[model samples]
Each structure stands twice: as structure tokens, then as C-alpha cells.
Target: MDGFPEKILLATDGPVSMGTATRAAVDLAERGGAELHVVHVWHTVPSPHARGFIRSGLKEIGQDKLEQQVREIVETGGTVAGAHLREGQAVEAIVDQGERIGADLVIAGSRGMGRLGRLALGSVSTGLAHRSHCPVLIVPEGEKAWPPDRVLVGHGSFEDTEQAGFLGARLARTLGVEVELVGVTSESGDAQEKLHDLDRELESRADEIGKVVGTRPRVRALVGNVPETILGLYAGDEKRALLSFGSKVLGGAGRMMVGEPLDEVLNSSRGPILISPELHPASKSRVPEREQDEGPQRPAVLLATDGSEVSLRAAGYAARLADGLDAKLFALYVVDEYLTFRSGVHYGDFIKSLSENGREATGKVRALAEEAGVECEELIVLGRPDRAILTVAEEIEADPIVLGSEGTSRIEHVLIGSVSEEVLRNANRTVLVVGGHPEYARPKGESSGVG
Candidate 1:
């Protein structure tokens, strides 16, 4: 299906961090043995009175910037196949050049802004993601290097998912890293059941991808706020992971913005992102079509920890269980608001202490999951530990909730009113409580008894 990029287009603006885009383009070109083309599109004068002189000056500046970038690429041990300087609107010029050259991928740089309203993507990058016929790789200003350790493919609609998965899997293979396909569904209906169905569908899709890509991809389906959930999984260790997703074509007859979830991800992600526009035609003939009612969900195992010794033990078990079951792992550490408020210590100091402890607790689980080669999403939130655990489990449609039998006074509160006894009474799902005798404890969710 021509998954591997054979021709790459690097679109640069004079002022933005062109070096970042140049380096990424070179690295990708070297890895895939692709031809790298550098292009700089200069804005033309609007008024006809000063058009000839101003336009000539702009052309000279564009040529110099384009040559400078080519030199930087050569200095960085990359060969540029072609250098293009065009006069027009930046987005239109870049897209036209990409299409004319039949480029497989387009690489560009963004400012990487900090706020939601002011997303990092400038008009050009956003426009490329929306209008380009090929996949666009937007390298943020602050990103370290290219050829990430892993590629995460975010599922959208059926066609988008198929195209994104194919491209992401190819990139992962070229980089010699693992690829994971993740789908996020809204928090409605039977989340667990939806997760189960999603998991099955992803498995099926993964099998098909394996047949083509020569390696089966790991799959995950989560139930929660769509953008937030996807961003959470994509968070932490941003430089090491590359997120690739299909940017669904939105808006009607007029020009459209980048749109919801992609917009949020662009604002929040501090890493390199690959956006495959819906108009990308490469996967239409390659990936087989599938009909489904709605996007499916996947299975996840939730581990609630308090940073106690027993909780660490439970974390290990949770990681192993997720690995064994081929499921995603959700590590949650909730700061106990009620307990912190009731403590005689100062409120701010006590809350800070809990937040630090929560980070440590979730960090341990992340490490354990990494060791086991399990995909783990770490979350540290503020609330009553038991209530937080249940809420997260329900939100993520976690099949089993893991906890420790014995803990500190903080967990002692959970044991008394929330965790073991109360959770067992209320939770409709599985509750695995790791106690002193780990071998003798039977998981509460399943009917199978373990002696």
C-alpha cells in the first residue's frame, strides 16, 4: 500500500525554528531512504503600487532562507534532493508543491504555544494538517529529536483509523519500535461492555495490520473524555513517543479549522505529531473496509495505590495481570482530600505532601508496567481515595480494580469506609485485594476461587 514514505516535503517559514523541521526531515529521510525536498513559501505584496519592488525583495529573502535551511540540513549530514522557493500564501503553495511532487509525507514546525485558546499550531501548520493530501508531521519548537521510540496511532472514524494505523505502523517499523493503536470513546452507556467490544474490534484490526505490516500492533480502548483520555495516554515522556492520528475533515463548504480533539492534542502535546488528513488517498485501496455501528472499546486494569509497601506489591501484580491479559494498565493515585482537610497540619502543606506522595505512587506503577512491557496510563487526582478509585474504574471501564489489603493511616481510612469492604459491596466489577498471603487471596470480581 506504499506505507513507507519515499518522498518527503519539508515546508518552512523563515522565522520559526526551521532547524527542528530540517533535522526531523533529514532523520526520516535517512531512515526510510526517502528523497527530502525543502520548500519556503513567501508572502506576496497585497498592493499593486509597490508590488514589483516589494515582491522582488521578498523573493530574495525567501531564496536566502531556503538556501540557509538546505545548508543546515547538509551540515547535519542530510542530503536535500530539491530546494523550492515559491511566492503565494504559505499553505496553498506548500500543498500544491507536495501534490505536484507526489510527496508521501510533509514535515513542518510549529511555535508550540501553551494555552488552549492560543494553540501552538500557526495558520500554516494547521492548514497543512487540514488540507494536505498526504500525512503531515508537525514538529513543535521544543522537541528534541526525531524517530521516536514508539508510535501511537489514535483511532478516529473507520477510514481515518485505517489510514492512520497503516501509516503509523509503517513508521514504527521503519524506526524499529513498537506501534500501539488506541481508541477513546465517550463516557456513556455500559462503558465496560463498550470497552470489551472496542477491544475485540481493535484486535481484529490489529490482526489485519499484522498481516500487512509483518508485526502485530498492541491495541487499547478507553472510556472517558475523548481528548483528555487520549492526551493523558500521550502525556509524560513526550520526546520519546510520536503520536500519529487521522485529522478528520470538518466544516462544510468553507475553510475549516483543525477541529476538536486534534486541536486539543496539538495544544497539550509537547511532542512531535503526525496528522493524516482525511483526503489522504493512499489507504483507500490498501486497507480493507469494515462496517461497524460505533467505535469499539478495549479492556483496561486499574491499580489504585497509596505509595505504601503493600500498594507497590499490588502495582507489580497489576502490571503482570495486564501483560498477561494483553490489556492496558491504568495506574491511579488519588490524594485524599477528606483526610488532608481533617488533619491538624496546615492545608496547603498537607495537600502538597499528598500530591508528592501520589506522584511517587503512580510513578512506581508506571515503572512496573514499563518493565513488564505493558501500556500504562498514570493519573494523579485529588479526592477521597475510594471514591476516586471507583470513579476512575467506571470511567475507564476497568474490568478489575487492584488495591492493597494493608496500608498507612491514609489507606486505613480507605479500608475502614471505602476500599476493601465498601468497594466490594458496591462495585459491579472485579476487586483484587492483595493481602499478606497473596497466594490465598481470591479476586472478588470473578467466580473462580483461588486457594
Candidate 2:
């Protein structure tokens, strides 16, 4: 299986925000011949004693509304496997109900665009993204009104190479639309590994998608921030593109652990973000103790080194993360010809000196990863700083790229154009633009997993 889902569940609330999800789910189910299940989780289940009393006295006004919604869906010309009503915490109920029917994809609505700085994602949609056993699809607000014309995949390293990226490509094949397996990157050094890896992976996925869709799809990766890069690609076609991504199932059981790249995109952006757990439920990310010894479960982390004060700090933190996740560490340093004052003319001696410095920087990071007992690969490449970093990360399929931040790099509004900032803006996978110290910063608005 190329990981395209077989059974899909649409979790709806009787609200305008659900418009996109409802349409997408029906379209996907109808087109793919996949079983479709629709679930409406209204509220928590009352106590047994209270239930009887409330049932007799309460009006249950929404029942009429729910039925009307169902009729419209049926009228749209698709058969529903089941349309269920349940009570309890919205996330829990949806997961539980979906599991009962063995759902492969869970679709839900995110709050629609309203006033500037106003993101009002329903609590249920947010919770489901963080906790569902299967994958999730967060429909952007106002999409119910427009059908998509293309599939925009936020492609990157880690589990997504095989999971979400491939699936998104496949979906694009199925839809017979252009597929953008886009990558956003930042770093300085050899991007060959990442680029090669991306090429091989996308080629393989295109072939697989070709089997089902009857035509091989095209794939490409551009260097930039994941969300912004994706949005830029969809700048004129926003209403016609469905943006897709992978989920973080391997870390933070009850908490949402979106990578920094996705964190930026999901917060204030308005779009459908198709998200699947990076690993299957049976995978080792957080598997049971008995499953621990069965396979290699560690994710890889990439470290971008410029030998700067901040880059060194990032290396130290990368080592810590490698040890924590038992992950492989890839240290990359780009001999930045662009950073040189005379590089515009390609001065040979200066370029040689820069290359030598790049090797030293990567060596420093390698030593750290080794000392921490983490698997490590060190490479020095000559290129633009940002592209080098992203390319290497992609080649190795690193789960996260770790870098020391000035705080404002990724989230800090002031240090907007720094290396750290560029990586976060354009990374395809999770990015860790770590600060020397820890702090909590939230985006300007409150929205669901998909803004």
C-alpha cells in the first residue's frame, strides 16, 4: 500500500466551518470508492441518571438541523457507510467512533477566516489532530464554497517521506491535478543528499501513484519556509489548492507536537491541511515496551552548522535531542560563497578558505553527536547557506533540523531574516530553531490544527 486510506470518517459539527470538510469527504469517498462514515459529536454524554431526566425535558433542537445536513449529503450523490451521533468529549468520541469502524482518515473542520487576527478553531478539531489514532484532514474555513484544483503537499524529511508526502502525491494522481511536493529549507552546505533523496523518493511515489491514476505525476521541491513556500505556490490559486501534511504521532502523547514549520503555518493560515500520523499506530515512536526490541524506531535529526556562536549552541541541543530520541544526527556545514564580500566574482582563495571552515564546523558538530552516543553523519558542501541546510536535511530524511535561535528567528518578529528564521519559514518538516534559553510564544490568533 502506498498509504492512501481505505476508510474515511468525516467528523462534523453543525456549523458553517464544517462546510469544507463535508464537501471534501464526500468527494474523496465518492472518487476513491473508499467507505465513508460521517459522525457528529455534539456534546459530552450526561450521567445515566441525568440523561433520562434531560432526555424527557430537553428539546434537542439540533436533531432537526443534523437530519437536514444528512439529507443534503445524501442528495449530493454518495452513499454513507454510516452517519452516527454520539455524545462525550468531541475528540474522544470521534476517535472512538472512527476506530469502531476502522477509519483510515479523519476529516474535520477548522474555524473559517473571520476578522483579522481572529482564529477560532473549535476545541474538538484541535484535540482530534493531537490524539487521533489515524490520520486527520483539517478543512480550512470557506473551502466548502470552492472545489480544489490542485494538491499542494508540504513535503519534507522523516516519516513523511514515506507517509504523508507519498500519500499526498498519490491523492494528486487520483485527482488528476498538478502535485507540488514542495520543500522549504534553510541551512548552508551540501544539499545534494537532501535533493537526491527528494528526487528518488518523489520519483518512486510518482510511479506508485501512476499505477492508480494512470499517469505519472510531476514532483518538485523549492527552498523556503514550509507554510509560506506552500502558500506562495498557491498565492493565486489558494482557493483551488488543498494543502496536505503529515501529523506528529511519535511524540507528545496528549499534547500537540507540531514541528515549528507547521506551527507557523497552522496558526494563522487559512487552508485545508491534510495530516496523517508520521508513523502508524503500531510503529515504535511510542510503542509498548514489548515492541521496543523488535525494530529500529529512532528518527534522525539534522544539525546545520555555520561555526557561529548560535550554530554551536544548536549543535549541543541537537546532540541532546539525538540522545533523547535515540536518533541519528547529521551535521552539515555550507561553505557560503554568498556570504563572502568578493564571492560575487568567485574568488578562488576565499572560496577555499570558506570550504575549509565549513569542514571544521561540521567536524565540531560530529564530535558532539558522537560524544552523546548518537549515530552521526557529517558533511560539508559548497552552496548558499539556506539551500545547503535544507537539501542535506531532505537527503537524510531528518525528522527535525536543530538550530540555535535568537528567539526572533522563527517566532521572534524582530529577527525576521536571519538563517534560523529562513529555515523555519521554509522547512518542509519540523524545525527546531532553539533559543539559548526556553520560552513560550504563541501566534497572534487561536485556531485549530489547520488554520
Candidate 3:
């Protein structure tokens, strides 16, 4: 099984202010046994006659910058998968390359573009966080380290906090780091009562997070400025701790709703923060009454099952999730072609047996979804499990593909258990692997598994 970061992309703004991002990328790649790739985008001012000359000069400069970053990595015993130099807008080019490479993570400096120039081309880090499909890690100007010793999840409202806490816990587990849920209260008259209430709230959140991630995190409640209190927790040991929250805290309209405290968090010069797009703030504008009442629709959740105990567990979890989010559920079972072909003499009989098993597996998922009161559709296909899951997910516009970490205990289908890992490595969207083991995974070409 492959690790969380099978591939890492570092989006550099040039030779200046890239040291922190480069270091963080190299550290993560080495720790996760991932391939490291770098890209730099350069463009000239509007010019018709001297365009060729300007383009040539910019390309040369971009190549030099990429080489420098690569050299630093190689010198530190890190391997470089590739280096890309493109001519276009920084955010678009970097986002395009990130998608093309199927990057598991994109790391960049927070202030890659100058402060004044940010108005023209939005901050690379912010733009990537808003645009990229993969997770974006923004390393502050002087911040260092990849996976800090401690991970702090800043709690806002219950909904956003839960979303951020889930993602933060997953990342903390993958990096093997200690995690804590933090909340801040600013009441003067009843300060003690507010603090107590806040502490209880954090503990309650921690319990719910433990139910999902299997590890109950520590909780901390403070009294001070929201951004200052959160950021100050690791001021001296910035390299040893990480701050994470939902992207809604950074949105224009969301900042006002969240309070002025969040504005400081975004403007604060200290960070090596992680932001999840779980809560996207809708732009404020006049809309029809009908559309307003309906609100925005969320995508369906895809559940891949193989009739195993763990698969059943995943089905229950996925069903509950779909119910909570008011999203549809898709239950899929893939008949491994490799197993049928390997049956040789009994190919026909084996194919029949597999088809029957597929129906049973998807049927179980449907039953679970029905119990949860979630709308569901059953799909059975013959192909590689990982490939079929991804293809179906794309076709249905599934946001998260859920499956068991491993599969049934059949010798011929042993490799199929690792299909979850393969899907995670290739899928452009989020993947939830229920009941996973310590080791990550990726399947070989010859795939056959009932998972």
C-alpha cells in the first residue's frame, strides 16, 4: 500500500522566498516515500513585437529557478520526479500541472507574489486552496517543517469545526502526530462560565471526532484574540506545531460572519497552516426565492463494497454520511477480470459465481442505505475494482468514494483488498478508507479482490 503522499507537487514563485516551501515539500516527500515535482510559471507584460524575446528570457529564468530548487533537494538526498516551467498565469499553470500530475498535495509559499502584486494575481497559496482538487499546504515566509509534532485544529462553529476536525485527525494519524481541538471565548462579565462552556464544547467535539477517526484528541480552550490565541500557541516552536481550519474562515463574507478574529488569522504573518474546503461560503447576491430555499446541492457519496465485514461497516458509515449531508448513495461492486481469466478451465463457472457475489455485495449496501433513509442506486461492473470505482465516481460526480481498507480473505482476491489504496492514489477527489491498517497500499497491474 502506498502512503498518503504518493506524489507531492511544489509550486515555486522563483528563487526568492521559496526556501520554506522547498524544505517542507522535501521533508514530506522523504517521510512519506513520495515523488517530488516542482513547477514555476513566468509571463511577460503585454507586448506584440518583443514578445518572443521576453518569452525566451522568462523561460531561461524559470528554468534556472526550478534547477536551483531541484539542486537543493538532490543535495539533501531527496529525489526529484520532475521540474516544470510554463508560461502563463501562476495560479492557472500551477493548478493545471497539479491536476495533470495527479498530485496528492500541493505545497507553496504563502507570500509567493509580492504584497502589491497580489491584487493582480491572487495570492498563489490562497488561489491554490480555492482551486486545486488536492490538499494545499501553505508554508509561511519563515515557517519550517512538514509534519509537526503537534497539530492544532482551530474550532469555530460546530459544523465547520467538525469538518475541519475530521480532516485534521486523518492527517494527524497519517503523519503520526499529536492533535488537539482548540476554542476561544471572549466574554468579560461571565468569563469563568464561558470558559467552562467552551471547554465542554471542545470535549464533546473531541468525542465525536474519536468516534470517526478512532483517536480522541486533547482539547484546549483559551481566552484572548481568536487569531492571536490560536497562532500564539506555537509561536516559539513554529516548526513543531501546525494550525488547521476550514477555508470558510478565510473567505470574504465568511470572515464577517465568523467575526473580526478570523481576519487576523488570515493577515497574521505566522503560519504553516492547513485549510480544507469543506465549508465554502456562497457569494452574496440577489437570487430567486425558489433557488434560495433549495440552496446548493451536494454531490453523491460512492460506496464500494465486496461483502466483507469491513465493507459492511463502510457501507453503514457511508449511508449515515449521505443521510446527514442530504446526498444520494451509490453502491458499486466490481467483478475482477483477473480472477475470471485465472479460472482457466472453469472460467464460465467462475464468472457466474463472481457475478452472483457482486449482486449480493451491492444488495447489502442497498439495504444499509435504505435503513438510513438515503436514496441509493446499485451498480455492478466487470473490470479492475480501482479503475471502475474512479470511472464511476467521475461519471456520477461523486465527492467522496468510500470503501474498506482491505477486502475478503480469498487467495485469488488478496490484491483486491488493496484497491482502496489504488483508488486513493489516482482519484482526483477525496477517498474514505474505513477500518484501514497501519500501512498504506497500492495495487499492482494484475488486480483481483472482493473489496
List the candidate 2 regions with Cα displacement exceeding 4 Å: 1-4, 16-18, 44-59, 112-121, 143-145, 157-161, 190-215, 236-239, 251-258, 280-451
**Strongest candidate by TM-score:** 1
Q: What TM-score do all the candidates reach, one by one?
A: 0.57, 0.57, 0.53
Tell how far residue 304 is off in model 3, in angstroms.
Answer: 42
Please give, for residues 1-451, the per-residue lDDT of candidate 3 as tens digits.
1235688899886654347778888877876678999998888777878888987887888888888878877887888999998888677688789889988778887654554443222245645654555567777655445447877887853225455677677667877888899888876768899899999988998999889887788998888667667667867553577777664421221111222333345445355677554323222231233246876645589998888877898999999999988998988787675564356433324544666677788888999899989988776555567887887677566778998876666542456557877898999999998874323334557456656
Cα lDDT for residue 355, candidate 2: 52
Report the candidate with higher lDDT, 1 versus 2.
1
Each candidate's root-mean-square deviation in Å? 19.2, 15.6, 20.7
Candidate 2 lDDT, tens digit per residue, 1-451? 3456789988776653237778888888877788888877555346767786675443253454466557778887867788787766567788899889989888887753353212223445655755676778877667342356777666563225345655676677666677765555544355666666767776676676567545555677555455566657666554577667776442223212324444445544566676667543422343454246556545778887667666778888999998998787877766553444454422333444555666677778888777888877665554456665676566556779887654323443233237677788889999988554333345558564784
Model 3 clash pairs are: 1-440, 1-441, 1-442, 2-441, 407-417, 416-449
Residue 25 local lDDT, model 2: 87
Q: How should the candidates be ordered by TM-score, best one leading?
A: 1, 2, 3
